[model samples]
Target chain A: MSNLFFVDKISTENIQSIENEEAHHAIKVLRLSVGELVYVSDGHGKWISGPISEISKKSLAIRIENTGETHAEKPELVVVQAFTKSDRNKEMLELVTVSGADRIIPWSSQRSISKWQSDSREKWMITVKEACKQSKRFRVPIVNNQMSTNEILNEVKTGFAIVFHESAKEKFSEISLPANLDRIYLIVGPEGGITEEELQLFSTINATVVRLGAPILRSAHAGFAAMSALQTKIGRW
Target chain B: MSNLFFVDKISTENIQSIENEEAHHAIKVLRLSVGELVYVSDGHGKWISGPISEISKKSLAIRIENTGETHAEKPELVVVQAFTKSDRNKEMLELVTVSGADRIIPWSSQRSISKWQSDSREKWMITVKEACKQSKRFRVPIVNNQMSTNEILNEVKTGFAIVFHESAKEKFSEISLPANLDRIYLIVGPEGGITEEELQLFSTINATVVRLGAPILRSAHAGFAAMSALQTKIGRW
Candidate 1:
């Protein structure tokens, strides 16, 4: 796997310098000597790769040999993940990020045992970015502000959404998904599960309630399972 | 969700006692009280559910109200996972177990960074059992002894298998899967990836090489992604 560093922008210049923490990571941690190949991404769609030209105290310069842009796939896959306990935060983010979630919404459901911390967003951003580099994904997922159940319902009203429940009669494979929609939302609840009133509210908007199978996945694992199934169903995988 | 404890066997007797470690877990860790509804499974489909009748220092008694058996789903979903580093052992097992893997095979691929420990099987079994309890799965996944590349080749020759590779031209959703298979083997390589010789070796046995998507998944996560896609593709999810 290629070691990828993030930059604010990627230009078409023949030469560039990588500074700050990423430079330290490249020089000290990864131990990349001069003339070693490396990749740099803007964490959107643009990326450039080249050989290291110089190693300096403050930064490392690279000679650009290739540049490309990754076109975002259509019918984005968005995951509305409820806050899990602190121990599972990294696991949850890694699973969804590698499973190709285009967007993520932090949800605070009625049954959620964990409350969002003051630095929750910052911590989540760091984890998501690391996952992007590991998965070789140039298009980083957009993480939104925490949402309440009512806010989630309002968001689902304008788009197609599927809520995974253990008691749902319909399986995810048995449901019909729209082909023309710009995005599909996958909703997962907390460890204690979703509330009955919240289910009724989602039903009012005609959002589909479905089960993945017999196994009851954790709140963290459910989003990844749904995304994988949806991506394959829509012929993306 | 009801707390589930594993027993060697679930009898038709009106009352049964849960002793040893399971009893400790319920009485101490979970702090389950008398008259609380709980479930006990034989770990091979047979299960009983009832309310606790009494709690003792060495045992807890439950009055059986209902007993049932889960028929094994046809065309078992088996994961052939290459050994991952120690840090990822729990994450790897949890993902596959929650994703509905019927069996798990440990593979020692050429590029595997971690060597199988003497007590690896015992540790894996413990983790898998805990995952089963959390996922509400009655039939526990079978964990086999570590197998070499040649042994895995022999196993693949006798069953239908799909090897997940990043450079494969075929997407998982684009392939034609047989409907009558008794089992489908999903093979995942190590973090460093499968070697060219091993790919050829699997190819000789007519194993299908497929890619999940553009994103490169970690070895710990690929099995879960493949299992989720396969389960939904076959209408099991």
Candidate 2:
């Protein structure tokens, strides 16, 4: 199937016009003509199927014939990633989006190299949105603003919580999968790794300390690794 | 601990001299003095601890005091990755090294983008060595020259062989851990993914087909995910 674009609105009855950037992309880049079928998702669970009705240099029109619900329901997996440098954080965000994480919480730990500003949060959201589109995800993963360790612990819902640290004794496969749980929270530390106080806080909250393997992966790699392993173990993969 | 370098040889009795690029780096960049201690690994599992004996612009010398073995006696995990474009292949190689794979083999698949040449093999080995140094690994992962998929499959030793494919019914965690097997062969396909015939061939040879998750990950990302999961499951993490 061809890719679907997220648009503001589509006229379901007769002819729908795509203007500005979308129109330019369809007419100039893709060179779509009349009667060409395409799909458009509004990024809100509604997907519209249509064919090109009119094509122009500045605008293109398509008639929406039918609509379908695009809902991908999986066990919610929240990735709590400690703030890394800009490039590493971007790669981590893309991985999390493609890995089907339900939510992403940027965390501020003692060894974090990058700090989030109020203005940059919206820009980061755009990156997540693009990743979601590329990965064919119907709904975008929620990117939350920076939060402290205590704030994350307090906000965690009733589910299986795991903190991946190198010092942990239990491997991820050894942990018992929790029954009757719809969410899983995974916490990954910064480059220098989680501090003693952070580990103690997670322990106090009864979070399982899970270790991946012998080699020490970077902070970004560890997040994806943990998510993949946990999802496979829970049969959600 | 400071970063360690891999050298060709270490003498037991007299002062060991570092020449060429390494000497320049030690003398000019780090500005290490005569009494400072430094570490060196021979890349053959020998780690040497010594103090600087002499320092100069062209050469620096170190007197070896003690030597020890730093090899991990755990199971060997080999990652066979299909060749992609240069940038993506480099990223995959770095991930394999960082993820603690013992060896990395570049194989030509039906949809491989880049063709491997004999002259470029040395350059690829350098990339693997650099990745090993950056990841703080004493033993550098071996980078084999490019070969065909059938050639690789034929060379697989007695171990738990698995291929990560999206069409696989069983999740990687479903495979039972083998007790006496010390080698695990992980085969990761290209961007277009493994062909149906390749999957059937692997099945005919008793190689287990394993799936990572529901979301479609890029080829490089899939290799890291599989390696991380298998490492954790086998108690090597």
Candidate 3:
């Protein structure tokens, strides 16, 4: 992969000027001269590539040789992650972003030890965007919504939903998706296990309760495990 | 699950005395009184659980109630993980431990940006041990000795080995395994990627080269992703 930088909005002009912090890092820190190849993305879907036309201390001009669109993965994978505070919070975001979760929902569970501040969502979005750029990912995963336990339970009723719990009798491997599915949701609980009321609510709705395996996994790590297992089982890996 | 503690050695005696930091945490910090239930493990495979007979600031005595043995998972899973420095190193260790990797080998890849110190392996072992406890896992995952590139390549000839590379033609989900295989090895490279010489060395030994889905993954997160994929494909998840 080539060196990829982020741009706010991309246009279809023959040449694009990068004047953001990314431009400063590329031109000043990286010290790329004209004619060196690099790539830039808006972190939406489109990316442009070609040699640099002009380089300066503040910005660089990219002579757009070709442009292409990177499509998101099919079936629209979503992870309803319970909020975990401190470093584990950032860890959950980084892992889900790099592991192919398309939409991440920060769910507030009753048993969650960590509470989400008002600015927490914005901080989470920043981390997700940077993670996408670091991984050279085009369709950046969205940390777009925060949900309550009841709201998430109601949300998963539309598509294939699997909750990862240690007490669940069924294994995650037993889940099989049907054809023409629109979405697949993996619900992760907090460090402290999901509360009895939350489990009852999900069970009342008849959501498929699944366990990763025999051993218990921490809440932050469970999301990635479930996502990977779902992707592999559905022939998406 | 009861509150589980750790002990270096266990026996068939009627009572076991808890000493050291775990005892301090349980007795002083957590305030466990007599007749309260708790569990203790050898950090190997054996766990004994019972009520507390004596509790003090220094130690606690547990009267042995019932002994149970937890066995290791079959068709042993091994991950050849390249050493990633700092916090990412612990992330790799935690993910693999909870995801059910039987043995983790810290490899010295040619393109590895991070170098392992003598104490690095010891710290890794501590993380693995803690991960096992946090996950309520019975048999702790092994953090074995380091391996050279050539040594690992030579060792994988007998078992099914797959190298995760970005440029590989085969997808990880596409591989088929034999029914009675003894082991499955997944080799993960570093952030700079595997060198040409290292790739050539593995190719010469006929190790199946494979790639995860389309997007690139960080060096730290790749091991868990590959292990989850393998576990799901092999019906172990």
Candidate 4:
């Protein structure tokens, strides 16, 4: 696989020049020579692949050989992840992104131990973007601003949502997704686990409370497991 | 959930004393006091949960209020993981353990960059045990010594095996597991990817070549994804 770099914009021109941070990464970090081939993605849907034409201190030109666009998946997979401690948050982002989550919402659930910072979204984007590059995803997952429990209740009303709890009586295998569903939200709680009151709140909105299995997974791990199961159930895997 | 500690032996005795390394961890690291409830497992199948009856400087005793045993899963889930760099190996161990891998075998595939150190198994066991405690799994996963390609070939002959490859045409969703299969091996390659020779060797043994989806997953994350999907398909989740 060719090394992929993110760019702000990708065009159909014969020759494209990459500069600034991404180019610096390619030239300095990756040490790509003038003739080496590489990939560039807009991190939405458009991408180009070709050999480097010229190398400079701050920029490199690529002779575009292939250009293509990947259409976003219908019924996008979204994750409403509760904030964990600083150490585990980045791991959660990488796991969910690699599992093909289309969007991610940082949730401030009742049992969450970490308070969302102003730069949390920015920090999360860096990890998500790196995961996208590692996973070869052209579409970078959107990380929404931190949402409160009430906001999550309102958000679940718009799409099919499943809240994973260890104590839930319902098994995820028994779920039957609607045929015309446009999006699905997978909610994971914090390390402290979900509170009873919050479960009641999601219950009132008819969001299904489902359990994965017997093993007690950490907050950083449950999202990846849920995403993988959902993707397999939806025939994406 | 109560914090769980691993002991070499757990008995039906009403009062059981936990000493040594596990006790030190409980008494010092976790700071448990008398009457504090916790669980103790033998790391095989038997476990007991109860309030602390006595707390000394180096040992803690449990009242053993509840005793239970977790039977090993039918069709045990095993991962044949190729050696990766040191940093990613620990992450891979944690992911697979939390995702409910029953056993793990280190493999030295053709493209593996890291050589198996003499103490690799011991180090891996420490990580796997920590994950088991975090995941609340009574039956801790067993980490086998590093095996060569020929050994892996001979091992796969006894049970079903699935090799995850990006270029494979067959999707994981298309595969059907055997009804009476005793064990299933999920093979994951290294960061450099699996060589054609290894794929061909596995294919010769009738191992199924399956792809998860379009997105390229890193070696550290693929085992967890495959395990989750497999667990769901087999109705374990």
Which residue pairs show backbone clashes in model 2?
A: A213-B237, A214-B237
TM-score-sorted candidate list, best first? 4, 1, 3, 2
CA lDDT of every candidate: 0.90, 0.77, 0.84, 0.91
All candidates: DockQ? 0.87, 0.47, 0.71, 0.75
What would the per-residue lDDT of candidate 4 be over residues B129-213, giving only the tens digit for each residue? 9988888889899999999999999997888999999999988988988799999999999999989999999999999999998
Candidate 2 per-residue lDDT, tens place, A1-237, comes to 344566777556566667877678777887887888876666666667778888876987778886777575555789989988778877888877777788888888888887788866787788887776666666677888889877888866466788999889887778886676777899999988999998998888899998876556788777887877776676666
lDDT string for model 3 (A1-237, tens) is: 567887887768988788868898887778888998888888878999888999876889999998988886568899999887567877788888878888998898887777778898899998988778778778888886778887887788877777888888777787777887788889999888888788889888777888887778777788988888887887767
Question: Candidate 4: global Cα-lDDT?
Answer: 0.91
Each prediction's TM-score versus the true structure: 0.97, 0.84, 0.93, 0.97
- Clashing residue pairs in all predictions, respectively, total 0, 2, 0, 0
* Candidate 1 local lDDT, A171-220, one digit each (tens): 99999887698878999988888889889988988889999989899888
lDDT tens digits, residues B87-188, model 3? 688888888888889889889988776777888788988898888877777777778788888789877887888899989887888888888888888999
Best by lDDT: 4
Better of 3 and 4 by TM-score: 4
- Which prediction has more favorable DockQ, 2 or 4? 4
Comparing candidate 1 with candidate 3, which one achieves the higher TM-score?
1
* Model 4, TM vs. native: 0.97
Ten residues in sequence with the least summed lDDT for candidate 3 chain A? A83-92
lDDT of 4 at B78: 91
